[model samples]
Target chain A: MALRGRDIVSIRDLSTEEITEILDHARSMIPVAEGKKSSSALEGKVVATAFFEPSTRTRLSFEAAVQRLGGRCLTIADIGVTSMRKGESLYDTVRMLSSYSDAIVLRHPNEGAARLAADASDRPVINAGDGSNQHPTQALLDLMAMHETFGTLAGLKVVLLGDLKYGRTVHSLAIALAQFGSELVLSAPRALALPEDLRGELESLGAKISDEPELRRAVRDADVLYVTRIQKERFPDEGEYRSVAGSYRVDASVLDGAKPQLIVLHPLPRAGEVDPEVDRTPHAAYFRQAFLAVPVRMALLSSILAPTRGG
Target chain B: MVRELRITPIRNGTVIDHIANGLALDVLRIIGVRDLDKDSTVSIALHVRSGKIGWKDIVKVENMELSPRKVNAIALISPSATISIIRDHQVREKRAVDLPEHVTGVVRCPNINCISNQGEPIESDFRVVRRRPVVLRCAYCDRQVTDFLRHLA
Candidate 1:
């Protein structure tokens, strides 16, 4: 049952019970994450943030989590300035970092790079994001946000809106939610819908996923409405991207018919997918979701680095 | 009078029999045609009628025995296939090819973005998700792979 020295490369790596344990640990860290209380759970520990890819929230939140838990952070915020620019392999770099750090938080442009890093490092490795492959912590925090709002993870109707095809967060979160017995509804444009293979996998996992073409319609009975931007960079054809760019915007107006208990979430740095006006609504939990990153990451850091102390 | 097509058996080598019909060539591809010693004789029987299975294919190679990995690759393509080792023109050992729980380096992941395809210093690892259809999931990135032929490593 111990997660000490374990890697969080993908949500699939953690079972439902382990995910719940992490979420429960995150709940207890909220006060400390907010600086209202303090503890030295990660005292004398060093967590490294190695980012070969550009990221804002994930890297910052992980660093912030380490510091809040009374641990120091070694950050490689840019690859262009590091030995990676000299063609150093991820294996060599992580192996060197593991010598100085107790845990490593890695974000890389290559998919599955974290797993390779984990193999190279003796210390625990956490995948911040790996090129459309996985961001397990984001899925964990998303789960934490949902649990905090609803007090449960099972049997909730969740509508996944926007770019399901290229949105890594939605893909990982969808799989995690399915494992927890959540009923999923997909609300995305035809071209940007969830891949058939992933849909088949979810269906095989006994998850009931329904397709609703309209976001407004899909949110009618959903307990959670998770939205993602249609990434323009992922589209090879600019014209095709333009056609679906504004297809599914979630404004306050769209929430008119949604259930009062329905909460809206987005993995942010959004580009017109969620309206600014929607941020003021009570249903807007994306900010809370973003803020939950600290405590959730703190929980993860403690689980991997301080498991013996039950921090 | 109708006559059965016959090819001479080798004195010592291996016989891969009961491959699903029309898959004998794939078995050869898995075993690598160029890898076989040019001096040894190899025979392929395609779409051969069989009593146990309606139609089957068999491949016999002289002075060549398949490794467990190659045999596993053959199993992925043809689950019902059996491998027989011959010594002194006698069948020494015969057993069905068994697909191991973890398949390594046999096939490349179809995911272009998969780390296994990124020239990393590790062979591709797959978990056997389904045996009947032979579904493989990449151990690194969690991508499922079902199409095995074109992506053979």
Candidate 2:
């Protein structure tokens, strides 16, 4: 259960026990993260964030996790201002960073860049997000949110809505939930629905997934409703993006017929997908979900840097 | 008038039979026919009619035996092919080539952005996750590549 020197490249790499272990540790970290209890677990350890892509939430959360645990962060100022702009490859930058850091958290534009960086570096490389491939920690925090609402992850009717194809968070979350034997309902318009390759992969992993475009079909009798913003950049045609964006937006009124316990979660930076009206409703778990990142990530940082776990 | 067909048998070698028509050359390239033993001889028959298949090709190599990898690599080009190991002018062992669980250094990833395709000194590896309508999953990027022949390294 001690994830000492392991590379966190994909959520698929973790066993169910390991994921549960993480969630259990996250539960313990809540008091410490809230400053009710103090811990100096990671006093001297150093973490480096190599974000090649622009990020706000994931980046800041990791820095907060490390700092709150009394560890220093060697965050890369900007890749554009660094040697990367001078034509340095990800491998070279990662190897150089490994010399100065205990662990490297990498976010790159290429799908397998974290894998390449892990192979090159001498330290554990946690993938923040590599292109549209996966974001493991995001999935972990998301599972934490689900656990907070449902009390457990198994057998819950889970509905994933909007931009399933390009949304990395949804992709990782769906795969993680499949292990718990959840009946997945994929609700998105045809143009923005989950890709067939991923759907087949999920099916192979033993997840029952159905295409339910209408929110009503998915909301009824569902325990969890996961909504995501549909990126306009993903659409090649401006008109096509316009037509699908408004149809997927969920407001407070949309939840009128939904189950009272139906928890609506979004991996944020919403762009007209979830209406502002929904934010005040009991269904909105995203804001609380964002705050939960602190405790969950403190668990990751502490457990990863603990001396008991071997590389 | 009736015509008598004459064929020469090799003492030791492999006979790759029932290759699809117009792919004999591709099969040769896939198996690295150019790297054959100096003393070995290769005989090829292309665009020939067969009872089992509409149009077929056959290749015979003298003084050489093909490995399972080579056989699998050849199967990518010609799935219907049968590889027969000949010994002392007799077919000792024969079987149809089935796609291997993994194919490495045989076909390059079609994605140019993939690590295997980039100039990284990495061998191209693919997992044959599907058969019938052959699908090769790239080991690096997990991209499904269908056009197997076009990306041969």
Candidate 3:
């Protein structure tokens, strides 16, 4: 299937083969992502980075991806200075932006905001992050990092720890990993466990899921330890947020019993959920996971912008 | 063998038969009871015995025909409903209302965070996940919406 003129709003929108193809293209883009080589795949094209919400890594990652592909960027890093503050709807903003750019990268504070923008824009739309709903590219990049380390997504034991309920990155990543037939062991506080509906949906997709209450016990036999931060903004009450804050911490002691090849991944902007001392260990792949965003996003942008470029 | 009619037959309107048990009022709301003509006569029979189904409700109106949109709305609350258009005391058209594959603009998404409920210009679009006991999921937010009556648009 042709990916040209398509929107990347949810990881669920991609199939196993399409995801594999994207990852394969990402492998070839590593040199470009590292600035060791450059490509004009998106030359003479303008990609708009519309961040209605605050984001440091994803916005910079998309800008880096676009620039590395030899494309210029039209950025709106702040919503306060835009027409949105003057009572403009997201639809109108996306419609106007679609007229000026070849493709759009949208990040909004509302759930399903990217889905709404995709319908309004004529050009392809990439969901950078939409509230606590979905961040497809982040999941894709996470998959890229895992595939690079392990050489395959199938049959891997992945332990998802921390805030599963409100972490958008985990939601998409868990679903994508399940699609690749990975065994998932969920470890989190009872209050912050993954939603039951999502668990059922993942099971229906043929995922083998088990629950482990202890983080240390869950990590003992895991291949990948994906940690997430407890989000204070997602809780309805301050007391509820306070109760679960600092519930699980991954330190060097946690990995003492684990296999040497076990890799720890985190979608950064950490709030001390993973200890800084753990970064010195060989198990720290979160930084590499962060850097993989460029190649994965570059693969997506090139596939959408230049489909006939022999990806 | 013939059974007596529960309500007087209309000469030039519509007779909706085989509505699910105790759903006449919900059907009324779905068709917008307030939007009906004041001059038209409306009759409803609740919990009437039926040979096909155990018990069903029936509704008859005089001098008013329901639009296709209203007929589709009835399918959500009462899947077994059959509409018979009467013209000069004869059944002009008779057909069972069908639950459309895709429901649009009729029922609002119940999720507060859904894009359709964010005061945007986009209409609420849902894919019918199941029939019999109808289930609809929002196209934008992927939230399953089951109670259709309370969230009617």
C-alpha RMSD values across all candidates:
2.0, 4.0, 2.1
Clash pairs, model 2 backbone = none
In model 1, the clashing pairs are none
TM-scores for every candidate against the unseen true structure: 0.95, 0.84, 0.95
What is the clash tally of candidate 2? 0
Chain A fold similarity by TM-score, each prediction: 0.96, 0.95, 0.97
| Alpha-carbon local distance difference test for all models | 0.89, 0.83, 0.90
Chain B TM-score, structure 3? 0.92
Model 2 chain B scores worst on lDDT over the 10 consecutive residues at B113-122
lDDT of 1 at A139: 96
lDDT string for model 2 (A39-71, tens) is 887899999988877878888888888888889
What is candidate 3's lDDT per residue for A173-195, written digit by digit as tens? 99999999999999999999897
Model 1 docking category:
medium
Stretches of candidate 2 off by over 4 Å are A233-247, A309-311, B1-22, B29-43, B47-56, B60-72, B75-102, B110-121, B130-134
**Recovered share of real interface contacts in candidate 1:** 0.56
DockQ of each model against the real complex? 0.62, 0.33, 0.63
